[model samples]
Target: MFYEIVTSPCYGTVEKVAIDKDSRIYEWEPLFAIKNMNGELEVIKMGCSGEVQSLEVEAGDKVIPGMVLAYIQEDILIGGSD
Candidate 1:
């Protein structure tokens, strides 16, 4: 198992948090809602399915491009120790 970091793609304020710690998330699932600088709302989605390990930001938090939003823990099937 390994962790994947979820990052923000724009400068905005977090409008809503869609998942909680330890929650399971699916690919393309909504993770957060952010209101961008131009007052446009953007819904951020998960790129891969995994269990949420931690959340780095919350609703109402300010975020910039490439900022970390959460950590996701996923199983890697290619290599494993039995």
Candidate 2:
């Protein structure tokens, strides 16, 4: 099973897959600014606000949507390892 990791639609750019010994993902930044007919400075901050959790699946690991990836629990529960 393969899980499709996707970003929210609110994100203007899609994450790019980096080909390297250590697979890294990155997203392109969009240029956004507010200006009148005449050049003027304006506040503009465009980007996604969230954390990308590290997945349990490695380079060649098979994973399903419902499969347990990683625990984000505040307290470690005993006998929780499956």
Candidate 3:
């Protein structure tokens, strides 16, 4: 298994945090709801299947593109490589 870092895709205020530390997550699962500078809401999704290692942001926090949001312990399949 490998570690993956989830990042913010835009400048915004974090409206909601959908997962907690140590929670299991899957690819494309909604992770955060952010209200951008334009007031448009955006859902942030996980990029891979994993257990969340830690969270770097919380509700009401301001975030910018490329900001680290969480660290995930990525899942690894046996025999077949990712």
Candidate 4:
């Protein structure tokens, strides 16, 4: 599955990118973090295990809540269900 990861609810400027494209990451892993307009840090986490497919935002980029940050292509589990 192609999964999209968005920024946290707190609007902010991207302070850092914790992962890179094609990087393998586990579920709940830290994908990226943003520094809110209020100077608070917000971390966006991966919801599933997968390889990073793309990154839409970079460090120092301005971002808002729910902004697309990156894409993750989740591992396929074939024959796992009937």
On lDDT, the candidate that comes out on top is: 3
lDDT of 4 at 45: 84
Candidate 3 residue pairs in backbone clash: none
Q: Which whole-number lDDT from 0 to 100 does residue 75 have in model 2?
A: 23
True-structure RMSD for candidate 1: 2.2
How high is the CA lDDT of each candidate model? 0.93, 0.28, 0.95, 0.79
Tell me how candidate 4 scores on lDDT.
Answer: 0.79
Question: Which segments of candidate 1 are over 4 A away from where they belong?
Answer: 77-82
lDDT of 4 by residue, 1-82 (tens): 5565655577788888988889898878877888888788877786688888888989898887677888788886678666
TM-score of each: 0.88, 0.22, 0.92, 0.82
Single out the weakest 10-residue window by summed lDDT for candidate 1. Answer: 73-82
Candidate 2 C-alpha lDDT tens digits along 5-78: 33222212212222222233233322122232234422222232222344343333333324433212122225
Clashes of each: 0, 0, 0, 0
Question: For residues 1-82, could you state the per-residue lDDT of candidate 1 as single tens digits?
Answer: 7898999989999999999999999989999999999999999996688899999999999999999999999755677778
Q: Distance (Å) between predicted and true CA of 5, model 1?
A: 0.9
Model 3 misplaced stretches (Cα beyond 4 Å): 80-82
User: What lDDT tens digits, residue by residue, belong to model 3 across residues 1-82?
Assistant: 6999999999999999999999999999999999999999999997689999999999999999999999999998779666
Give the distance in Å from residue 34's predicted Cα in candidate 2 to where it truly belongs. 40
